[model samples]
Target: MRVSVVINPKAGSVNPGLIEEKIRSALFRCDLVFSKAKTLEEMDQFLCEELAHKTDFFLICGGDGTVNTCLQYLVRAEEDLTKIPPIAVVRSGTANDLAHEIGISRRIDQAVRNILEGSVRNIDIIQISSGDKKAFMLTNGGLGIPAMTADLANQVRFSLQKVANCPQTAGFFKSIAKNSYQLIKKIGPGVYSLMVAEALRTWDPNGWELEFELPGDKKFATNAPIVLVNNQPSIGNKFLPAPFTSNTDGTVNLLLAEGRRVREHLSSFLHLRNGTVSQSDRFTSYEITEFKVRSKNPSRPITFFGDGEILFKDVAELSVKCLHKGLPVVVGSPAWEK
Candidate 1:
């Protein structure tokens, strides 16, 4: 009983031979394998040498930055502690939202026959930082203005956010207008926080100056621009924002838009097409494990991202926590979410 599949096959409508012909017809004896990461340093050496522990399971298709690059080598080998494995997914690229919140299967032979009829679950990960150079170990990280629209939707890789369901205006305003001239030839000073969050429409955007601390000592600013630091629930599940974010919740919710509930998340676009965007106010909501992101206008630092990819800027500080280091997901028994 062995299984290993990490085929990205350049994602986006991937067809690595139709996920190797339906995981070779739903593993009649299992032991099927595939790994074609194609650089994130060869998927960090096929996820730390032969899919770490020669695959008991490791299936992933792309998007959510290749599931945060295979959870940054399985969460830094458990923060350099090691010995951890269990992950499965297939919802190929373009905002699958952790495979629709760990349910997997946008249909690759029914997510590989529910991983040849599965068993396993323990999910929750989100750790980013600026102190020791760890910026994105994600399930979607964040910073104000949807962390600069996930760094302008990772510089235009086939715009219109590869097919958006409004994922923050097609993944952050069409990745800052289809990669603003190749991100101004590579981060030439975050094009002034991408032109002050596009002429102050607000992503907590307008005119720099940042300072934040939460999880208990609550202090803040994005110069009174509404806020949003969520880890997942689809930033474009029509802005479900942090709608009770939980993968087993260690905690990192914080959705503050403040005062008049930041005018109900800046008039939350009249509840975008019915996803209900949790109708902003009471400065959103807050739950935490750790936090801090500072900016006193040190040239518009205040940058960080994961699901959208950025990572950093002139930023002086950044941190997020909650790492119950989990993986190994597949749950479908009500005759499969019928």
Candidate 2:
């Protein structure tokens, strides 16, 4: 097999030396072309120039962002999907959301073994376009509270990193802290009320206007405080905002929280993990193949984030469509095989 390996040495606080050793041992009997990319630009260049053609497979050793970056560039490099190589991800980042959803192992040895022995499965990719920019999302994307929380979490992460002096360690603790806080806030006594009060006091409920077309071409409009479009089940590590979501299903799940007041917003926030928010009168959920979103006022731009990174901001309009079974990925256990 002609395999191309891309490793992000800075991912998930993994020891670069140890990962390198594992990679060497795993591919000892195969033809290997390896490169380490510490930044997105390097990964882009490598995909466009070196790994664009004639590669049988791509082994990505990093987290969601690293994997997203490689896939984005690969999709851009070859307009022909058949020319792109099947990818296997080694879960080496904080919040390996995509890896976990696809049943990829976090342990390096097991992941390597899976890469060598696994079967390929076709997976769906969310193609997003905003004005002149285009990108692809492998996990979840959202505006409103989801975007707010992401921005807040990044600030907290960077602040903690400044004190810890290690990005991986900071991220580890950040995940723990963020998850714990969310759990407590959701289940603690009076915490739900406190959250609602705080949200009412601080949050701008109708920051944007959302217009979407359902699967049957039915048009709907709403003033949503938050709109989350999911291709996977979870958001952060533990938040299963859309439990029914599947990346290979040729559809995306949209969760719209239509709560404008304290009581309505509180209900939406409280039911986020259980996905019962969809049952709420103020919430709307849909499984659709394509949709469009835009800010209410063109001058007042909004940001939508996906796969733990900001995809686009300061754009008046955006659109997302699922390219059903558009990318081939190697998995330890194929869901369809069952």
Candidate 3:
């Protein structure tokens, strides 16, 4: 069999030497082509050349961002979706949200083994559009709090890199900080409540006005501080914002917070894990096939993000639709066996 392996050396706690050794040992008989690039531009070039070769599968060793980037290029290169090779992922990222959802192992050897034994599953993809820009999302997409937090996280990472003068050291410190935060949040839900309280000190509740239409032409409008559209159940690692969300359900789960005060918002957020936030008077949740969102004030565009990456900035309007069975992925048996 012929395989194309795309590895992101900087993803999470990845040890390239160990990963490469495992790959070489496991697929010793298969014809393999390995590609690694530091920048997106370089990755594009490498993908263009490597994808043109007739290959059986793509083994992607990286985080969700790297997987998303590769998928973007693949979509652009292949005119026919069926012609694209099935993709298997190794969880080499901080969150690995999608990877975890698909039951991919974080261990390097086990992940590779699963790739060799996994079955192809058709998963939904979200098509997002704003003006002339369009992209696909595999996990989750949102505006408001998610976008805000992603921006803040990026800024923090950049500042750390600039001050530390070493990207690896910066990433190490960032991982430690994030792990600590996650540990605290896991230990007690009150940690998130405290965070929400602190965030409300500067958070503007009237940041965006949203109007959405459900499957049956049921329309609703709201001025919300945060809006999250989830295709997968988990966000940020362990937080289950939409516990019942299913990627193959042919619908997207929407979590909209209409709270205007810190206490109200905090109360709503605290119910995320229990999936009772939707029942709150201050929050609205919907299962819709498609939706359209525009800033209340068109002059002031809202920032939007998906899968922990910024997708649009200063965007006046955008639409999102669930693309049913859009992606062919190789998932571990644990995911499908159930």
Residue pairs clashing in model 2 are: none
lDDT of 3 by residue, 249-335 (tens): 888888887777777666766666566665677767788888888776775577877776777888878888998877888888663
The runs of at least 3 residues in candidate 3 whose Cα sits more than 4 Å from the true structure, single-residue gaps closed, are 166-199, 215-217, 335-338
Model 3: weakest 10-residue lDDT segment is: 185-194
- Residue 302 of model 3 has an lDDT of 78
Q: What shift in Å separates residue 98 of candidate 2 from its native position after superposition? A: 0.9
Question: For every model shown, what is its TM-score relative to the native structure?
Answer: 0.32, 0.82, 0.86
Q: What is the lDDT of residue 218 in candidate 1?
A: 77
1 against 3, candidate with superior lDDT: 3
Task: List the candidate 2 regions with Cα displacement exceeding 4 Å.
Answer: 158-202, 213-217, 334-338
TM-score quality measure for candidate 2: 0.82
Stronger candidate by TM-score (1 vs 2)? 2
- Residue 267's lDDT within candidate 3 is 70
Best by lDDT: 3
